[model samples]
Target: MHSRKPFYLLVALLFISGLAASIYRGIEHNVPFLPGKQVQSWAVDAKVRFQATGEPAEVSFSLPEDPAYEVLVENATSPGYGLSITSDEEGRRAIWSIRQARGQQDLYYKVTLIPTGVKQILATEEPATPEPYSWPATEQAAAEQAIEEVWSRSATNLSFAQQLNKALTASERSQNIELLLSSNRPAQLFVRMLNSKGIPAQAVSGLFLEDQRRRQQLVTFVEVYHDGQWHLFNPVDGSQGRPDNLLIWDRSGKSTLDVIGGINSQVNFSMLQDTRSALATSIDVMMNNDALDFSLYQLPLEEQSLFKGILLIPIGVLMVVFLRVIIGIKTSGTFMPVLIALAFIQTTLLTGLIGFLLIVAFGLTIRSYLSKLNLLLISRISAVIIVVIGIIGLFTLLSYKFGLSEGLTITFFPMIILAWTIERMSILWEEEGAKEVFVQGGGSLFVATLAYLAMSASWVQHWVFNFLGIHLVILAMVLLMGQYTGYKLLELRRFKPLAGE
Candidate 1:
């Protein structure tokens, strides 16, 4: 039955674990705070009304040129109101009017706009487009001419041109012209050329799908205001400066184009001005809300005050397991050393270790001298405790005198543990000699240092805090330590002669 205790404990834990999982899933999936699917788009209704004193009020309504599929004006009821559809210098407008209300009369008009297309328009601006020009027939002559023209251009006006001239000249002279032209950097040179010629041009960063492979294309599109309309120009492919196969933006509307630069290629282009989807935003908010709710429930009230202290337990346990199972370090009690180490974490390891050692050493020294008095073990321990306290007081006073308040505070040093260690060390010193006592005391301090390091590690703290499920990590460590059947390092050293066979 004693041997079956662990099995029953494990079974009970498993049942509780399954229960917790089911509860979590139920809450996370069913609750509004938890993340589910995203809401894709929003339906908006906008209405505008106008009233004039004597004359008929003229009002216009226009919709965004974005290709939203569902847009309608519904329940637009205004008695004795005039409505007209008109085309203006701008694309289109709906005109309506209502007589002035004596007091405050309500007019009802509802216009609904729903997004129809996958791609949304982002921006619109009018750009100057330049005429198409061809490069020299041969690649070599074109490269040379491009370099010369770029270098002769005005420095103030064509900075990009000058830089491109230097780069192209170096590449051509080295016979690496193909490598340079194949890259997207040359698009900047194209932009410089258009800008120098008084055509508004800029380089655009976007992904391009090609027949063989998908590539990132940095193309320069020139916007020219000509013939009372804005046009787009692409000099790289000699596209005759048209907006048809180019994505360009001006003050007017966002435009996107799909182009197939190579022969026998089909390209499709789409644009989205508003990058974020409503569903994605909603899902993010839900996930955050759920996480906060889970945190509020998972943390226990009693442990909340010493939350940081409780967090150090796994690290301390790991150190204890490593010392006992791997290194075979023996201290006074199981887990007592880990608890002591945690106490050390409150006051750093170095200061804690130094203070601990000093107090223990002073108490043990006093204990040995008082052993000549032939007192009982309890009385002897009591006397040692008094001496330890006196030594702590002296140490505190000395620290203050030396302006070391930080160091002195550690002198308080869990007095009970210090007194017990002193008694144990004195016995070991007397019976087992100085070496055994030093080894055990030093081992305890070494274990404490390891625990301190593990507790302080940022990654350990992050994992433990973010995933309270990491208590499973501690359980896993416990299981691994239980199954460790190998000989300890100390045992190997002591039994070295057995290995010689």
Candidate 2:
């Protein structure tokens, strides 16, 4: 006479938590609710070519830095050189050094990146301090005059940058603008002027992504620190905000490539865009987001594949519960069908069914003979276990001899479960008569087949493996069903005569 309120409340809480967690994972991690969803990715290849001096050579190249995108993979092709990745205040760089080199040396670095749909504002704990500027008197005068003019025409830091960029690229520019452009790059001068006015700014390089493009080089952009976050602006046209296809390559205001012992060194990029399954991208996102600590994906690939099959057990168990509790279907051993369904996953439906029937039938014949010995219960079960193993081996050998390769999978069946099943059936036959044995045996087979169908489904496998919350939901459903006290569907047939009355 326990209160059912607590039971119902527990079920509701479990269901809600499971459903909410699954929805959050789908939206937050970009995991597709369904399989086969596609996500865009880009692969960029950088080729560095230079003439060697027959001496020890060293080359350094900058790596991409974009908070809006996640790097999926990266590697370098340096046959004779030692490659290593190093990071510093400047940023991450790939350095390749060789003991001795002569003539033309070619090096290649490649990377694949996927958009994360994250905002690209750069935030720092403390406001950046501007670097000291010491140019020649004429250049200093020019920079100061240009800054004054832009300051007079602008209010905010962003507006001042826009005005200065416009003046630098004007159709008819002023004398100071011409002087600044003669000796300095546009983006570099723009940043310097912004910094001289006590606004922190830096010149960064970005690549405008285009499909199937080759021999591409990085373009410079100015990043001005305003309102506590760095905002990107195209110094060429003063267009503000980061572009959807722009990948920030270098933000350290340093050289992208530096060769210590080579001449005429250059790096050119080739890029291609493609699409992949959203599931694959989700793994990358999880790895980048440090979600692997709680994810099955963190397991080695072999273990992950093993769990994929193991995680389907609950689906089979759920099917068994529904069939037995709601429909009053009698099964030999409450969950033996679930294990049999697991075997079916390995051996496939037809082969597993045939193998199961052959082994059980052969074992039952031997089990009947053992019943005459009047052995102890434990000893009787042990004898059946050994007999079940023998039956499995004999059937497997026969299948192989007959060239039925599918029978090899019979080894995957749980031998102890089969032995216990045979023992139970033999006891049931002796006590309940042969007709009752067939009824329960057929029901077991029916339930196992249905469980196999449910567990082997593609969508079911995807959801169970990708989202652990599904197991919780299944647990809730099973618990709720356990409390049922209503009439079974099969039992209702006994009242058919009353309908006519």
Candidate 3:
């Protein structure tokens, strides 16, 4: 006897691998397991305004970067100016240059990103020793005293920096704390103090994102090298780690915007937060990243849409298998219901059903008349196909004349399938009478309707399209159903007398 073990093993493998891939994509790519989950996306617009000096002019604007978000799109708008984007160890920058410019000038930069809600940890290469700041004599004395006091209270570099920030921003500050705050910004002082103690640190600019906010300015945050990575801290509140809504825009410790040969140069930001389909947002994020992902989302829009319908066929096939093997439904032809159900997706349920019934009814009438002509099998089938097309065209014209636009979609049905179906039913009618034809035809329609309902569901479409691995699970199910050799559900009634005996 042949072993069923190999078949079961293959089925288990397919099921497990398909489930794992789907779950992994859902978690790693931020794709929700269900549909309609919304993701927050931010649209930021930066406006750079300055007065041109009627000579050559150039402006460099720093771009935003954060590990918590993935940028989907970035663009710049500057008329009559050459724009060049450059990326380096520092970060990305947009440079706009123009010759013989005059009067006021405005350059705009726009970007869209979906936040991943992951915290940012600043990382950099080994840093060179920082140069000592040239502080005034009294201020210098205060600095040393403040650093020594904060150092005594803390052990590690992160703790030391946090304590220094706490001391600088305290409400009731000491004499040295007051001296330090009077001369420098809290973030700058925090970094200088950390550097003075031989720790690597820098003052970076972070933007606090708010919905529908205009004229937004960058806030200073201190970054200190600790435990092999740089950590961000709020100098004002001594809070460690990055804020969820705060975007680190400038980390180079340089000016965020620089305009040469222009006066009163400044940059202003406006941002709006919106929600979008989580799946679409996740797909966009994956496309933007360098990670290896296998998904239909990578296909072109047209092909992706086609695949959306194609992928649904397996679902209809599964329904057909269950109905035929387990329920003992007698379809006119195997797999025909799946094609009909797919057509129903385009033409919709009620309209497709009505259209299918009318086309087959008319085609069978014409086919019955042609069957008496002694035509060859191929010629008869080909003639039936032509007759089906004519019947559909006639129905469409009639539908349009009567203002029934849905009937126009009847053409979406496969003409060849309809032809073959009509020919089979006609032949069945001649051999076994009309009752068997109706039984098979009705069964096919019943199966197709059920399949259509399953395949057309929003959640079903979302899963099948987003997760191709699911088809394997469906295939395994169909294969397992193929192994069923017991009496069909409809055949059980014939054994009722035997059971009673």
Candidate 4:
């Protein structure tokens, strides 16, 4: 054992070196092997600049809404300001409150947006019917007459709104409609006139998120409710639908920002497009640490799925090595315990244990009777195979009939291997007596259980799958175990009589 230590140490060194190199390559490539979801994400970084006075300062900015898109996470940097986000009956807003300050101050807020792929237009708590606008007397009659003319030409609510929308914003509009635009914004004016005619309508501001845009202005649209749904129409061209990338902003029709004690307080946006594992990204952001960033970040999702389970097998093998070589667990076969452990993972611990015990106990009874026929070794195993399968079938039917779905997973156990295990235990009982047979059989289950626990662990599964070096580390540990020449833990117990002497 002493002489072989050098060889084992070298093997361990090589495994470590190989693992390091693989991890390095994985890191360079950004093929994430980590156990989590891979999500395509967008980082919308917004900067708000203002010059603060030496008094209390408060800044409020309206936030985005849902059913259009979702804010997955958000963070802000305000060197001297205290930031707080609040939501009310009106809408959600971020408020930065400061006690006192002087000179130019820059406050930054970053929002990560994820497309939900499902749209739902949220209902505001406004009256079931829209309230008519209060306009100056001269404009009121002209707006009402113009809206009446459009409403008369159109039949459906949507069509009336569309026709009205066009007449108000058309480049060569009629005298009444063009005068309305000159004094008021087309979208808002059209909505008020619409309400005057008893149709529920409102103007909304939104952002069309396409490319990196700075100091972007909100695009307004007129929305009319009919048939239990809100329909958006472009105020400029009377277009019927919103852009696929539209983000509804300032929906409550509130001012985007309210600032006191700050001059020229304005927001600028800088956006970057990147993809990350959605499940892992939040954790990564929360940790504020990137020490574990590896190349296995964005490999094909299917390949990542394959490696996750595959990598855990080595850890199971290491468990088997330590149990058999160092602890002297007398399993029926070498390396078979690892496969059993894998099956246990699918079936779960308690159910698998119960199923395994039931099958083996029943198999042993059949094996004893088979021995009476005086058959050859191959014939015996083949006969046991048929019987073991029959046993599995019977158990599955009974379990299913009784509604124990977990027992159905018993099929994942290697049927052939179970047959062999029954045969080995039977033969071992005949040769070494019943006590030894029970000891070895129970030991196999014991070691396999330990292996399952190690492989099924969350962190172990993550490390092995993500870092190709983890298998190397497992190999190194197994090699180190191989150099253990001292008495097995069980062997040491056997020396109790010698010590008693």
Candidate 5:
């Protein structure tokens, strides 16, 4: 039992494992299983428009990164502007320079993003405590009182930062906080006071992403180090964390855009929402993996497009196997239906069937006449091919003349296969009568039509192209069909007479 069953059992197990792994990976990467769950992506534009004087100009702008989203591409307009992009320990920037400029000018930076919903660990540098700020005598007394008030009530560095932040924002702030914040920015004062308590903190800005945002601006917040990690806090409400929609733009709390010869420089962001296929998004995951160097997505664009069509052949093969083996359908050749189904892909099903029948009928008639000539096999086959080609050419030209464009696709039918089919049917008719010829010929067309429907389905095409492992499952199905020794649906008709007995 073990020896006989092990082979098929192993095949089934491997097929199941491969199918499960493919589906698991697909779901893990957010590939949609059904039609309704469209993949979501975002396109963001950072427009920097400014005015230039009749002098040399230098403009610098800070860039943003969303730790939870994948950045696909970055495009910037640098017409007439000397553009230089560099990132250092401080942060990244885009600097645009020119020799001479005047009047209104515009520059744009755009980025495409796909939300992976995966959090990225920020590469943080050594945390440094901010240097204490100088204060005038009057301000010094108020600052000392404010720090002492919250520090006395706090238990740890984190609580001290939280408490100090609360006091600065409280409706009734102590005299020191009132003086300090009135003279300095709220986030700026928060960082200074946090370091006064020996805690490292940085003022940062985050962008809130939304659909159709016209002129978005950055919101500044403070990041405090606690337990070996940096945590976000709201500057206005002094909340404990950032929002889900927030994208950290600047951690240095420095200027985002800079211009020497340009003035009134400002940055406005626009956002657009896009719904993409889940399979397309899965390709994005593969594109990021270094191990997938040989994936279809890594191929040249032309090859990738070609494989998109080639991959669906397996689906056609599966359909043919089901129709032939499991359903007991008769066909002209073993795999001829599969090839016909492939041709049906380019030429639509209705037109393909009509063209197939018309060509075969006429070719058979001509084949009958040639059969009486006693020609050799090779000569007769060649003659049939020439006749098939001539018939196709005539149909194409007439269709074009009459504006019946659908007939143009008749060229997609395989000339050699049609010729061979016609020759086979003519010989079968001469020996086995017209009835058997029609039965097998109709069955082939029927199976090919079903294969065409299955192969041309959008989801089948997408899945076959996106997940290559699905072929193992298809192979397993064919193997199972091969083992079917029972009566087919068509053969069940014989049992109808037994039921009466």
Candidate 6:
């Protein structure tokens, strides 16, 4: 029992060290996703300088056409005169100026570049053409042409297809559509049919009314330009296709009365397209932002490999503590049983347990039989060692003969530990009784099995891996265990009669 104090002290120290290390890692050692071979952009203000000796150098500056209006070029010269200009990319520039220099004097110019916004556009499509058309009539004509084009390409004359396609193609110059079908949402069928004929169409997933209750449904909508307005089509029930129900809200954010298309007929209308409200668009933006944020910190090289397993050691230690201090299990060689259990983690609990039990059982039987020969203690252990080797050799031969390569790996099962355990158990059997030896051996195995289970639990793995700080939870557990002075559960069972008095 006095020896047990050192074990408890060792456990306490380990707990404190683990707690400190985890906290240090959480605060000081951040495992960030460091930027690799990827391009990153930032907006900055810098001064531009140019020099021309005998002849003036022709310098031209350009900026990305955006809403912020921050691009400014200070100095520009043709033949020793300063010039300034402001225009858009289609027009001229926000601000461009020129400075004149003759003899090798450096001209100082400042440019302020501001970021308006960044958009990730698919590379599959070419840049949109910037062409303006007359309002009202132009918009009406374009809408009609787009609808006609879509109708001509579509295989189904269903009212839903006609209305949806017409709306989708209305703003051909501004809108691009890709069609996809999803079995989960039948409404996508209409979208796919329209897209098959070269109409830009896609299935939209959102909540729609079904049977008077608000429920999730996929709606097929199309982009349309009408009356100088770009709108998304919301077609009501018709021979083509119609959703069971629809909800509407005006531009003022007021909810409009629910539109319940008659079983036979539905309303045909268009809505303004807001990419911000699109689920897919929003998800893509979030993923990209998170990816970029992660690509900023560097993690340790050595930790990169062992990080996962190292995080799980706390649970393994907890299992060891629970077995020793709570369940009152006996094990030979402090932590050797847990280490064996860790080896089992590599092979898996069921197979490892079975293999270990079989090997130890066979080795113990050989050791017991040799004990009848009156061999010396060391000689008896050595004889058991030889028998264990022979058993491993036999197992390997049988595994190879039967094409069970898995069994061959168990041949490497820490033969020395097996020999030592058998020798110890034999001593216990002789000095105390077979029951005492069996109880202790069984207790060690029980501890190992518990350790195995704790290490393999998914939630345990996830929490330990994601939030290293949570290791303090394990530390707290150890601290609580340290103060536990009550008899262990097994000891309570043994002392029950005394307590009953």
Cα deviation of 122 in candidate 5 (Å)?
5.1
TM-score of each candidate structure, all chains considered together:
0.45, 0.84, 0.91, 0.53, 0.83, 0.42
Per-residue lDDT of model 3, residues 373-462, tens digit only: 989999999999999999999999999999999999999999999999999999999999999999999999999999999999998999
lDDT per residue for candidate 4 within 1-501, as digits (tens), equals: 358667866886878786776577455433345556576666777677888887788999888765666576788888777989999876888899989978887888888876655575746544477666787987978877887799889999878888887776677888888778888877778788788877888777787675666676678877788777788888877678768877777767667777898898777666666777754654444233344454344557787776676677888889889888887888888877888888898899888899889999999999999999999999999999999899999999999999989989999888998999989889899999999988888888999999999988886776675556666777777777876889988888778999999
> Which RMSD values do the candidates have, in order?
19.3, 3.7, 2.7, 22.1, 3.9, 20.2
Local distance difference test scores for all models: 0.54, 0.90, 0.89, 0.78, 0.81, 0.50
Q: Residue-wise lDDT of candidate 2 within 1-501, one digit each (tens)? A: 888898899999999999988888899887888888898999999999999999999999999878887888899999989999998877899999999999999999999998888766667555667766776887988778778888999999878877887888888999898888889888878877888887888888899899999999999998888777888888787688899889999988899999988999998999999999999898887887688787898889999999998999999999999999999999999999999999999999999999999998999999999999999999999999999988889888998999999999999999999999999999999999988889899999999999999999888888999878878899999999998899999999999999879
Instruction: List candidate 3 stretches off by more than 4 Å.
Output: 122-136, 290-301, 371-375, 495-501
Q: Write the per-residue lDDT of candidate 5 for residues 1-501, one digit (tens) a residue.
A: 347487689678869976996798577655665544566778888888889998999988887655676666677997898998888877778888899989888889887777767453344566766677766776778777888888899998888888877887788877667778788899888887787767888888778889999899878888888877677778688687757777777775687777898788888888888877666666665666553565677788999888988888878888887887778888888778888998899889999998899899889989999999999999999999999999989888988999989999989998999999998999999999999999999999998999999988877876787677888888888777777888887888889989888
Clashes (backbone N, CA, C under 3 Å), per candidate, total 17, 0, 0, 10, 2, 16
> Model 3: which residue pairs collide?
none
Give the RMSD in angstroms, all C-alphas superposed, for model 4. 22.1
Candidates 1 and 3: which is better by TM-score? 3
- Candidate 4 Cα errors over 4 Å, as ranges: 1-38, 124-126, 278-501
Which 10-residue span in candidate 6 carries the lowest summed lDDT? 253-262
Model 5 global lDDT (CA atoms, 0 to 1): 0.81
Best by TM-score: 3
lDDT score of residue 350 within candidate 5: 91
Ranking by lDDT: 2, 3, 5, 4, 1, 6
Name the runs in model 1 displaced over 4 angstroms: 1-305, 483-486
**Residue-level lDDT for 416 in candidate 4:** 91
